[model samples]
Target: MAERTILVAGTYDTKSEELGYIVEVIRAQGGDVVSMDVSVLGDPPGRVDVGKHAVAAAGGSSIAEAVARGDENSAMQIMARGAAAVALDLYRSGRIHGVIVLGGTMGTDLALDLCAALPVGVPKYVVSTVAFSPLLPPDRLAPDIQMILWAGGLYGLNPVCRASLSQAAGAVLGAARAVEAPVSGRPLIGMTSFGKTVLRYMVTLKPALEARGFDLAVFHATGMGGRAFDALAAQGAFAAVMDFAPQEVSNHLFGGLSAGADRMTGAGRAGVPQIVAPGCYDLVDFVGWQGVPRRLEGRPTHAHNRLLSSAMLDAGERREVARAICAKMAGVRGSVAFVLPSQGCNEWDRPGAELHDAEGLAAFCDEMRAACPANVALHEIDAHINDATFCDTVLRLFDGWLADGTLTRV
Candidate 1:
């Protein structure tokens, strides 16, 4: 194997010793280092292959211009953009295999944008004081980022800081060395799900799709997972999409467990062949141990685990969510259809279940049918989401699309 190059980025003016130590550790772990300086206030402390001036220029400005303005916030933004451009160029040229970034609040903020500029498979590690904070929203976060808490990294080198940095160096380098690009001879199908109980039909659909030479990529409907699914789908990563668990879309609409503001619309916008389903749109998730919301205290609720609590959506909210889904799917250039399971949408939405709201489901179905565009087809199956019959119907429709030239089989 050839020597792998790792990009080490940060405020080299202040964290010079720390950045130097990181580079040394990555080299020890068999990774060649390419240093990038993102400092605006002062000169870098050591040798920087990509200097602040070059980075600033990549971001559409000059270090001199940024420094002359003297606004720390604005200056940091310019550096961040510059760092991202440098990283992107390096990746495109196959010069960098991975990235290890270090910072506090300011550094982490800059690193977030830099990491986002890279594709999903690239290894991105951030050693930050604010690794697990609400300050980093989904829109500002890269789904595959590996963040390590800067336990004792606030100041100069220490035993604690070294411990975290050493592990991070090994992790990023190891990932870069071990990971290879994804290859699928068959068409890739993106599917979304919450849990086995919600979309158990996946067990059946997976085999059927694979038998037809399609590669199935299932994504969990957790906040970050949904974002990754949407972002990747929009990037043309998937040939088709089985967007069953659109609960994240419902969650975002009602300010619940939002995947992000840009959840259900990506695959449609990208014109990917998609089969949409309201798999778990009947409920929105929240942290269970945190106690239920005061407004939803009286609504039907189910605790999937200590961390995940789901609340049933009411009739009005369900109708609105269905309308939103229809609005998103209406503009797809490729074949798109809604596979509505009339018996129930998810496990807890079945008869006698805690989240069973027949009235709400009916309202959702009505609104979807009414709002669904002429280009989009609606298939209402009189079976539960997890039922074999529903899976059969979905597979049959997909087969029909392939046969009719609506979907070109790979």
Candidate 2:
């Protein structure tokens, strides 16, 4: 195989010894290394391939200007922006196959920006003191970025920190060499849902969509999964999207497990044709490990697992969710179809189920019908969301859209 080049980046002024050790290990493993220094106030003992001046200039600032700001936060923001721009350029130019950045909290913040600037398949790793901390929000994380805790290496490299750095170096190189970047062999269909227990339509729809000469990518509707789905959708990565389980919309609005405020807007913004539904829309998930919040104390709740629990939304909240969905759909630039399964949205909400609420369902349905914009095609199906009839309705609509040129065939 050809030699893979990995970009080693960090605040070299402070962590030069650590960064150098990583570079040395990569070279020892027969991988090429390119170093970048993102320091604002000081310089590395030796020069880097990309200097701090170039990084600052790429960010539309100067090293002198960054230093003049005096505040460390403001200065690091400039370095982060510049580093992201420079790293993206390296990837686009085929000069670097992977990147590994080392830092504490400030460095981790910059690492997030740099990783987010690259496309999804590229290898991006962060060796940080704050790796996996709650201080890092889910929305800021790139879908594929890896993080390893920089244990015992915050100030200087010791045996413990060296162990982490060595492993990170090897991992990024191996990932770059082994990664099979996403290929567009067939038209891709991006879908969202929870597990089969709650939303089982994806189980049937996956094989069905594949048989129709398309690839189906189902994203779990949890916080980070929806973030990944939305990120990919914003890049116009899908030929069409089946956004079947949009409960993340409610999660975002109610401070549940949110995928950020931009949830459910990705495909629409990219002008990709979409078919949407409200599967599991009546529940708001919270971190079960943290216990139920005070506000949700009286609501009907279901504990899915140790990690996740959900509470049923009241009738008023259901109406609010319906309006939110309609408001998001109003801005679609391409064709959109809204399917309202009248019987039930999820298995938990079916007749005699633990979360069955007829009044709340009725309120949601009424508001959806009343608020659905004129531009969106609303199909109020009599079947439940998990029913075969609902799947058939979706397939029929998909086929018609392909035939009518609303969606392109692979």
Candidate 3:
């Protein structure tokens, strides 16, 4: 029943009127608002609960020096660091319940850094002119940020801008009020897959894992989802990871969407028990509407939706990806298993399917077997990846890992 607090952060020196209006909207909606000024320029025109001077000091700099230098980029960077520190303090002290930020490229950049410091489950929204631009990379964006394109939100506030701001305020506060934090007393298992064609094993595997007292968290193998999974895994957020799809990993290597620099190796580097598979390994995803690369025009592909397309990999590419996976798994200190479905990686890669490439699969398997390390066990199954038999094999191996202390049972 208590009032929720929302942090409204922006460069008050330039966007004072807009930010002030947002604050008023939040307060009118029965929410407490905290105004943070991240400007490193001239004095703020209005009242700011958290001023630029404090922000500069928190970032290990002084406002006077930043202003004197007159460098927009340098000042913005320092202010971002300071704002993040202040926001973290506010959240820890229970003074802020959610965050709403608005800006062009500069404002959005600062907001991204600030929101990244807050843990997941905190509602964070941004209204930005560049929300859908390709200029912003996935790694630069916080996984939980809900962004709305700042259409008509330019120099001054208009009806269109106000509508966007008001809606964003409502969304953040409502989320903070209504959404309960996720509860799972059992150990969490992270799994990755794309669409049904690639990960039908989830239908049976999920309940089986739950019956054994483990909660499964599945990440779609989209570029962003894979990166988020890798980030969380590296943070030691899960006890084990079933990385059943490495398509995003291949996608990244080829400059496609959802590929972080360290996608597949996070669990291994964190020493978390991991069972890796080449689910959808024969495909790299791209936007379905985007122009296909001239070199890859002849490769087999499947359109999963209006937005997503999966392109088949050639034998050379498959071999390289296999080597990459092996090299990464070799250094794992935790228990690791490399499971490959011999018949096919995904449903689309099976016989009679357009993406089915036996030669490519053979090349990948040969490279994987030759390059797999002694410590990491490699299991080659005759069934397709989604087949119940394949899932059963994975479950059995998972149980063995638990019994042998490879994966701790919570």
Candidate 4:
């Protein structure tokens, strides 16, 4: 509620003065500045350096030297540890309203370690040299993160970098002023969704989730998003998971572009009520006209757009996907339910489409029977995932789970 305190953090041992200049610019814009100097192996003399002591407090003694002795990897590990510790310290002390860092590649990753650790709505911005990675930046931000990268390590605060970074600082400070701080989820529930099919859910589920007096978090159905839900479920961040789009899991099995790390849908653990559905499992998505994989080239492929693609599953692939899905469902604790939409899972999976394969459905069901636990339940509905019936079913199951949550005894 008081004025926001911005945290400008970096390896101050070397770039102390440089970062200080940036901090001065931030202060000039009317803001409080707390400098977190994560000089893991070294602490340059600065008026307000706060890293060496913080790192030592977090369990590292002479962390900077240790980092220097080890390879850059080790240095980064120590630095990340030090930065995380410093950021947490500053955040808890109520002095850090936002965070900023400046460095080359090492600094970029190092600062990112801290920036990427925060929950949404805590203003975060980073200046990095490697801004070319095609993958989206970390999700520590509700709005997209602002990244500034230069080609070299040394500069006298060039006009472009200064303007860009100053803009970023202004953005961070403005965001802090305009927004109320975030409240972490209570009895957190994780849901997997895609921007497409599940977009309407924001209206339907957001209020219901908030009204239940529990925190509900929506995880994008990108490969990493699904994996994140599983990990969060395992972490007990939430006692229940509502998995709407099982596209990531299907991608892992069927060679889709969204195929991320394995164990895609394993949110049910030790008794978490995992109400799941193969929402987009109806087809695998690809990029480009070369959408069909070699194995499936002879099968059926549909061109959704100039660069986007979808493929119909034959009976065999569907069975394989079902087996994988069942395996994931079996990992959950207590009652695990995977609802199937018979009318259509995706646009291409409906009647009169190229993927209306009942054989595939039968195979998936049979596979679940063979692989899932006895307690796991399956409901086949005569509607698509967006249909009224499926949505209602999802909400009812979640409410039931909240009332009967047993995922974590503690």
Task: Report the number of the highest-lDDT candidate.
Answer: 2
* Candidate 3 all-Cα RMSD: 2.1
Tens digits of per-residue lDDT for model 3 on 173-210?
Answer: 89878766544678889999876856798888899999
Candidate 1 to truth, TM: 0.96
Model 2 error, position 352 (Å): 0.9
lDDT by residue (1-410, candidate 4, tens digit) is 57777888767778776677778777887888887766655657756656566654564655646655777667566767777777866777777877777777677777666765555457777766665454444332223356765434365566666666677677777777887643353566778776653335545776777677667788866555665566566555665777777777667676676535445444555355777777767577776566567755776776757876767777777777777777766645556777777666655566676666767766766665566666677777778766678777777777666567643323
Instruction: Name the runs in model 3 displaced over 4 angstroms.
Output: none
Candidate 2: which pairs clash? Answer: none
lDDT of each: 0.87, 0.93, 0.84, 0.66
Error of 2 at 127 (Å): 0.4
Better of 1 and 3 by TM-score: 1
**How far is 45's C-alpha from truth in model 2 (Å)?**
0.5
Sort by lDDT, best first: 2, 1, 3, 4
Instruction: Give the worst 10-residue stretch by lDDT in candidate 3.
Output: 176-185
Which pairs clash (backbone N, Cα, C closer than 3 Å) in model 1?
Answer: none
Return model 1's CA RMSD, one decimal: 1.5
lDDT of 2 by residue, 149-260 (tens): 9999988879999999999999999999999877579989999998998888888889998888999999998888888888888888999999988999998888798988
Off by over 4 Å in 1: none
Error of 3 at 151 (Å): 3.3
When 1 and 4 are scored with TM-score, the better candidate is 1
